[model samples]
Target: MTRNKGADSVQSEASAVNAPRMTDKDFERFSEFIKREFGIKMPPSKKTMLEARLQKRLRALCMNNHAEYCKFLFSPKGLESEITHLIDVVTTNTTDFFREPKHFEMLLSSVLPDLHKRTNRPIKVWSAGCSSGEEPYTLAMVLSEFADKNSAFDFSILATDISREILQRAVNAIYSEDKVEIVPMALKKKYLLKSKDRKKRLVRIAPELRKRVDFRQLNFMEPFPFRDKKDVIFCRNVVIYFDRPTQNRLFNEFCLRLVPGGFLFIGHSESVSGMNLPLRQVAPTVYQRI
Candidate 1:
């Protein structure tokens, strides 16, 4: 017996209600823009944030709202460097020091100890999609404690992001108390300097930690521009924006850049199980290059 057409129609209607109201054209524009500017793959759930960010842009430009802005975006001048400015305006970057505590705990308890035992050379770490400097700075602080001033087994951290504004802010290393509140008191005292001025209620990362980290601008989808095999990479949360195929490509590239036995830390919601890479699962959201 054939299924009833009405039943299928009812099922389709239910799916529509659960789905976001974003149109295919709107999603397509946002996807293309994000891919070009930040090497991020756009997930379906990002429709709300993208709409909210770009809606304000539309109002600012005084164009015919999102529809007109979309058309203008496809114009000759729109696809140029203007796209970078667009992403800087719309994408949401939420990060904090030791944001995912487990990853850091793993690093301090297990990963660092092993790396230290193996070699006396300064460890090299890359914080791809470093986003506003928290992850890299956290890496620096942990490595500082772990390495213990031998200076031989010291560490250098390279943190990169696609946003120049965020990069500059990351380099500034100054943060409001609200942002730094979650950091432990001992860590806060060690790695952060509290501002005393009444006008500026902020904390700045200590010079010692800041100097160990090098901040640069990098788009991950492009070729691997920097050369050393990375000992550790914290690329968490960034890839959730990417589609499956893009995620696969990124994992492949990461495998190439990571040293054997190097660690790749991803967001709690991300994994590489089906990516067909040479990485072995170490923990939830953590992988070791095999």
Candidate 2:
């Protein structure tokens, strides 16, 4: 006998509403797996946080309990398809336009000029963990403006993130008005397009600006796939999630991909001090590959 469609719908809705909370045992398993796979530390303090993030996944998978979700998440099928989504849910993707304005100031005054002298080739920049495209788009605008005043100054940007969903949003290049408020009016007017309908307080990056940036998915734990080395890498606020050993390993890997004297800008709150790497501090939280 076939089940009634209406009853099935009700049952599913009820199951979601009353889904079981993640148990401590399950959280422990998840924390260990996440740290081993992604290099993200998940301490006991974050058990509630993990539980909350994983709930949406359970709902999406139509699973009513942690047991059901965990079983699928570990299965071969789920590893192939659902793992990306799980990674997306777990990672925090906070970003803003022109965050840490001093970095841009240093870029324009010091880094750009140094690179321009070397060759007329477009300066290559990589924005690791670029969330929703704000940081890279900001970089594009900054670089474009700099190119206008300087002769033979051009650049390309590569924005990468571990989260597939956020990368897609970054590709869309759409943002609410408030999201771009911190952006200077001059740059916004030049690089962003207003929505055709005035009723919607949304904007999109200008086509030229959007095209200048290439968005890709990258996991710090995985081997980086790049044929050419980058001139500068902006990996701000991302390493804070990893443990000390992981951070050191990732930074060393970045150094391997950077041209000698290539600049690295990290979040002001993070430091690369005490780690043995082929880098020297040039400015606050900024280093040059040696």
Candidate 3:
């Protein structure tokens, strides 16, 4: 037993010592690869983050060093998997239910009602870059409330992300109490139910709410396939990684996707002042597709 324990300890030490040192070159390669593939620009300052996120992938693949991983990624045969992994690791997805509350309030109080009145058809909302599904689920909860008590304004929530892995998790629609704490109390009662298992103090979204959202893997650089003129599109906290030209193109695409007078919500740090899309600023980080 002692011999086996010592051997395991030595193996662990060896693995730690052989782990890849993420240097400037590796960081540049990651940034450039993402840019070329997705038009997403990751700054060199995110080297530490690159290490942290990619280290998981290396560990999964049982790679001892970044050199071998980099070689594999650069090889023609490995390019497809490498680009998919790049999208999974490089895109930052920090979101929650009802994040930036004021925006949701605007969506609930204004956007849904106006769109419902305008078109006899369903109000379509797209949660672009919907990390792990909280945003779209939250949207469904609000829309459900509106639809139940009020007119039967049809609605569908489309949740999309570049990472299939994350999209799968989003489709699962399970989250710990810690993640759902920011969800308003009323919504908590209306849309979520605690799991019977005590080990997991998490809640599953109510089926009624979950049914309203359709989760899909979508890369923003490509032409969006959905033809439904959207009522509101949420692309929050996502564009800061893109270069100015990419952001300009993204805004143009968003304008094309939105119906006239539909809304576009961006990250608080992101703005379209100089890009000059038909969008008019309605609030900080919010615009109307005019």
Query: Each model's TM-score?
Result: 0.83, 0.92, 0.89
Which ranges of candidate 3 are over 4 A from the true structure?
A: 1-18
Model 1 weakest lDDT span, ten residues long: 15-24
Tens-digit lDDT string for candidate 3 (142-176): 88888887676778888889998888888888999
Could you list the CA RMSD of all candidates, in the order they appear?
Answer: 10.0, 5.4, 3.4
Better of 1 and 2 by lDDT: 2
Query: Residue 233 of candidate 3: its Cα lDDT?
Result: 91
lDDT of 2 by residue, 129-179 (tens): 998999999999989988999988889999999988999999999999999
176, model 1: CA deviation in Å?
Answer: 1.0
lDDT of 1 at 160: 86
Give the better candidate number (2 or 3) by lDDT: 2
- Error at 242, model 3, angstroms: 0.5
lDDT of all the models against the reference?
0.81, 0.90, 0.84
Per-residue lDDT tens digits of candidate 1, residues 187-216?
A: 888989988894788999999999999999
